[model samples]
Target: MALLERITGPRDLRDLTNDQLVTLAQEIRASLIANVSRTGGHLGPNLGAVELTIALHRVFDSPRDPLIFDTGHQSYVHKMLTGRQHRFDTLRKPGGLSGYPSRAESEHDWVESSHASSALSWAEGMAKGFALKGEPRTVVAIVGDGSLTGGMTWEALNNIAVEPDLRLVIVVNDNGRSYNPTIGGLATRLHGLGQQLSAIRTDRRYERALARIKRWVNRTPVVGEPAYDLMHGFKAGVKDVLAPQGMYSDLGIKYLGPIDGHDLKSLELAFEQAKQFDGGPVIVHAITQKGRGFAAAEQHEEDRFHAVGPIDQVTGEPLTTSSARTWTQAFGDELARIGATDDRVVAITAAMLHPTGLTRFAKHFPERTFDVGIAEQHAVASAAGLARAGLHPVVAIYATFLNRAFDQLLMDVALHGEGVTFVLDRAGITGPDGASHHGMWDLALLGLVPGLRLAVPRDEQRLQEALQACVRIDDGPSAIRFSKDPLPAALRPVRHEDGLDVLVEHGDPRVLVVGWGQFATMAVEVGNRLAQQGIGVRVVDPVWALPTPKALIAQAGAHDLVLTIEDGGLAGGLGSRLAQECRLAGVRADVREFGIPQRFIDHGTRAGILDDLCLTAQQLARLATETVLAGDPEPAPDQADQRG
Candidate 1:
């Protein structure tokens, strides 16, 4: 059997010899490439952190010590050593291993939150818990250079610096990239350190100078030991001709190394020393390459293959490439076109330039584009500032990520009546990435924001129209949301009536079906199915789902039953809002809502998840049929208005 098969757990890794450990690292990388190629996951990050992870497991006792990965995307190798290697093929699939660290998967896995820059805070709390309970365990937080861009990391760092007795070890995995090259002041200083490390490695003069200083300090009597200790603390300064290494040291945290992360010996030594240090939290800076062993990932510049689909392992080419335009692509292309004519429009994203489809806009108008380093709150506030300055700002981000900036969106934008357009991509059931990745809460969450005009476009044409319309609104905040799914064929409305698109109509319609965004297609299909079953149905799409249209409410009063279908959460969704509107308007209509239940939907294909939620056309058709039959055909003369 190969070396990988011999190791079952982190404890087993301790038994392996140095040469065997190297072989084990090689085998693990091979396994990662092979399995991830088939399953498709966070390939580059896992490959880069192979040696670092091995060293960490060997140094720290997990489940007791609690190794917390910052964003958890880089925890695949950690998963392998924790007895999950056997089931690695099921990564990111329906009923298999999660791409990130899952607490349900093992006791070794502590915090599973994939949100960036929160590992330090989790580690601090755990360290405090261990200290208070008299437990002799160290808390390990393995955070990336990418995570450092988030402000929460600094908040935790500031708190951890003051706690002198906290047993915490923070390993900084500096690969110099988070999706793209890490920007901002900290990354620049770290980049300088990388350059300094290279100079120190090549030049013998620097090493000799350090040796002479150590000797001189040792030669002196009484205060020699204390002097040497002080001098040793300032050693990083001796080589600081390139970059000052006082970022962590300035915070009063014990800083160790600009060590080679790929080197197992260096990583193990740093981790071992960090584990032993109880003098507050120790920061072990390990500089590794993002796409270390993978040539394809290393060469391909954009995001270094951060997240990949199924690909040819050798060539690093996608196994199957679709020419079909995605919702993101459509939105991006339209935004870029809009930017050409509308010079007042500026774009902002929280470190997601390519993913959110803002790349084209950034390329065309570089000055107007701002990549706000994984800080959603900063992005929203900055966009608000931009809007205040008389410029229309388009803030694009994933629907789920916007949850963090809700306060900023409410206070800075909505409160001030800023004309900021927030284009939320992946605003529906995003499959495989699991619960935290789903953009299911936006419709409900945005409903609470007063004066926030929200649009849920049905197709590519509607998406373009919505974007144009949202950008034109200069009074209050406007938002347009679209899914991660492939862009469906354009569906023209049979008639446009009072801001609602009537997609399908039946003679003497008794049932009025309302669909929002992508579900509009499914609603039409449901209507067709009902039509064949001898049920007169009229399906309509509320182009803008928020603030339930007056026409829709009037239409509902005409029909006996009103069924609303949406992809968002059932609570406070478009469906729920329409029902509430009907009640408030004194329209005597039996309103039924169909949407995703207010719960965490797990990892699966979008189709599978939708089916599981009973949001499919066939399932909905059967339910609608039952509902219509169960209800009264005619309303009382004193209640419902029969005028159509």
Candidate 2:
């Protein structure tokens, strides 16, 4: 039978022997390797979780008992077993299976989370809800060891520990990485502690010494019975001291196993034991290797093939050649240049050095680059501290992840008027990863910050100029958000002026097209198309989206119709700000907003999503022409009324 064809669901795997379970795991791995190689999704993390996932499904009744995956990148195995196998071939493609878990995708999936450390909180809430209704259902939160570094996980742990009857099981899948693991004093200490714990488990000499101490204590006079009584206490104390028990055991949650996650027999046993436990939150610490079966993934130094675009299965090489430079690479190149010229230039990231394009800066100036692991709050506050010390700290982070540090950004950085630069990658509707990963809310959230300067670049030249402009400012915090799209050909000669640039002009009754970031190219294209239809439209690029470009505002007031387009959300975004400005200026021209809706968009190709949102050139042309024509008033109805 075909590896994928052998099993219909989790029920089919229940009767399989241990040997057969192992074979099933291998088959799953083979299927994943083949499918992901073609489609290019998360590879290493899925490979590591094959047996653990199988064991999880076997022990628990999913859909009835929800299995929540943190970050959802490693849910490939879960998806396969949940009747999504046929659609697996279209994984991460436009209008196909999402890379992350979606509640809409299956009954088995509960919460669809791409942000790290949120699963525990979601599980806690669900478990609490279950308890309130007297619903008897198990809630399992599978969190990667990498996710442990996030501050919210600790917050969730603190909350979950207090609820002794919540019936929550936290499976810690420790593969020892959150992207590329950092080597610091804390890492070294954790390593030493792990080694000591391993020695106590395996070395006979240490075991014999412990045994001798136990025997000598039992052989004592009046202390014999008392000593014997304390032996169990001593063992428990030692276990608590040496292992991860100190972290959660003190909080009243049961700590079980640093088990072999790859071994199906051991994993099944652990799952069964955990299910039997009746009180509090329980953490089953499972140790597994990332990219367990694949040689190339195992050997990968960074991220263990976390996300690949398209690749050759046999040789593990990228299938397509990348001619256009990615936004990340552009940021990296610009930061590198900035660092080399300025001695005070420094960079910071919240455990996303490579993803945020700080890897090049780390290589160029290792001492200046700081990787504060999975702690966005700390990263932002630390950047404020760095700025206080007279260093220009550029904190590079994804726009979505920066949501974690909004409070810090507002209070610590913006309020204090710190000269910290924030470079946000994936600033708009990022596709395939789904709604949680989309960088849609940054503009609205950051607009609330008091003295923060905001910049949105349309192309490579503007991106470079924006970065330069941000670093040179000494007054307050500044953020520059850019998309994943390649630099457009039309924006090649576009220089970053202090304010907006008028790209096109036609006639006295002008229609101003206010463009922000990469969407400027779209505006220009729309303008040209409308021009063909005999509608005069002027295109303007505002390098600065925030501070409400005064010059641009004046120019917009001169036009008969004003259209503001951005990649971010329309609520309290560039469009909202521009409309407010127009209202304040006593301009009666029809001000229209063009951006993403308030609701979350689903997973699809970027272009497809844009088209669906009516953000394409054709859609813009139609809307603009209609608006302009509708605004044109009745010419001579007043003549008959005046005569009467």
Candidate 3:
């Protein structure tokens, strides 16, 4: 039987002997490597976590004793063990199993999280909830060392340390790279100290010599008193050097292990000991290699195959050419261009150097670029500080990730009217990474911030212009949000008689199409299709999506049927804002809103999602034609033609 077939669940896993378990882990690694190569999911993190995951399920009872994984990308093996092996083939595809943990998928998955450093806080809350109810259950939070760089983890650590009766096990999976670990003085010192301690622990004479010195000091005369004190001081210094537990020890949490995470026997033993310790909070630091079994992923320099698309199974080569330059690249290119001209320009990112497209900026102007690792709150506050210090700071961040630091943006930047420019990439729906990674909420959430100016560009040209305009606005916090979609080769400037442009005008149309951002092109296509059916429609593009375009409201008043289309959620989005404006303006035109619903959209191609939600050209054309002839006395087509 295949290794995956032999194990149906965690219970079946317990029945395997030690050798079989080892064999099973190897088989799982092989399968993970093969599948990820073909389908292209998170490869290295999952590969590194195979043995640790096996050890976790073997030692702890999940579901009953909930196991929460921080940034759940490392939960692929856990998903396989929980009877999701069959759906592994369609990983990250539309209508398939999600890439991250889903509470809707199974009872075993308690919390679905893909954000880093959040598992500890969730574990703390769940542990506290259990304590309040007087319930007995183990709560384990498996967090990686990279996640520890986040300030929220430390905040949770401080709280977890003080909670006297909170039973929580924090498993720190240390792989020694957060994208790329800083090769600073602290990192070098820690590396050397770790090696020295390993050598000292192995030598039996070292321990014996220390015991002998202590005994000898007790035997000496007047020198004994001072010598004993010196010995005690030396021991304290040695403890500080060897242990390196100052941070956690002061926080009042018990720390265990810098153990070999791949050794199943050692891991099992350590877990057994941890279970017995009736302490407030315990941390087990396990050092494992990302892409542990697969040589190709192991050899990867940075991120260790953190995220990938489809590739060849044997060589690990990508199956296709790189797609067009993304919005991230555009933002970076624009920033670099601006930086060349402006001496006061600086860039900031929350641990995302490559993702935010600031790698080139950092290379050219190393002193001006700051990568505050996985700390969005700090990124915003620091940007605010930089802005206050007479420098123009452009904080580039993902729209979804920016939600983490909304308060800082509102209070530290916007409220104070700081000249911080926020270049938000992936502002709209980002498909395939699943709900947690979607940039849907930025507009709704950020729009609520007082005195903040928000701008969404329709194309690459507008994006460049918006970036320039936002930075020039030194009065307050201004942001420009753009999609992750490939920009058009060239965007024709919207020719405006007033402030709005009529992109596609069909005279005396019963319907009017209002398009926001890049969705304008889709509206034009829909209008063309509607014209073939003897239906007339007008398509208008609003370059400015916020502040309720007055030109758009007047245009809506002229049509019998008005439809607003956007890529964001209908609730509190452009469509919602338009509807409110229409109501306030007392425009009685029959208005319809079309966009993503107020629910989490699943992983799929961007086009596939648009089609699924009936936002495609065909769907839009059909809806428009039907709405136009809804109340009219139009003759029906022949029964046979209608059926066809």
Best prediction by lDDT: 1
Error of 2 at 458 (Å): 1.6
Question: How well is each residue in 469-555 modelled by candidate 2, as lDDT tens digits?
Answer: 999877799999988776666474244344667666555546788778888888888888778878877888877888888887777
If scored against the real structure, what TM-score would every candidate get? 0.90, 0.88, 0.88
Query: Whose TM-score is higher: candidate 1's or candidate 3's?
Result: 1
Model 1: C-alpha RMSD to truth?
Answer: 6.2
Which candidate gets the maximum TM-score versus the true structure? 1
Q: Kindly give the stretch of ten consecutive residues in candidate 1 with the minimal lDDT sum.
A: 635-644
lDDT of each residue in 1-644, candidate 1, tens digit only: 99888778889999889999999999998999899999888888888899999999999998788999987899999999999999998999899999888888999999996989899999999999989999999999999848888989889999998898899998888777742343323444465465445334334465478689888888899988899998776665654544334677677776666677788887887777677664567787777777778899999877777889999989899999899999999999999999999999999998899999988999999999999897898899999999999999999999999898999999999999999999998888999999998999998889999988988998999999899999999988999998999988888899999988999998789899998898899999999999998899999998987777899999988997787888787788887787788889898777777877778878989999887777788877877787677654333221122111
Q: Order of all candidates by TM-score, from best down to worst?
A: 1, 2, 3
Candidate 3 Cα errors over 4 Å, as ranges: 178-237, 489-494, 585-590, 632-644
Instruction: Provide backbone clash counts, one per model.
Output: 0, 1, 0
> How do the residues 1-644 of candidate 3 rate in per-residue lDDT, one tens digit apiece?
88777777888888888889889998898888777777778888888888898988898888888989887888999999998887888888888878889888888898887888989999999999998998887799999736877889888888898896788888878776642343222333464454345344334475478679878888898798798888777755765565554466567676665557788876776666566566567776667788788776777777777777787766667888767877788888988888888878899997788988898888889899998888999999999999889889999988888889999999999888899988887766788888877788877776677767767777778788888887887768888877788875553633674566677766577788877777877877887787788777787777777677888887788888787777776667776677678889997666677777667778887788777677777877776677576753222221111110
Clashing pairs in 2: 164-280
The residue-level lDDT of candidate 1 at 29 comes to 89
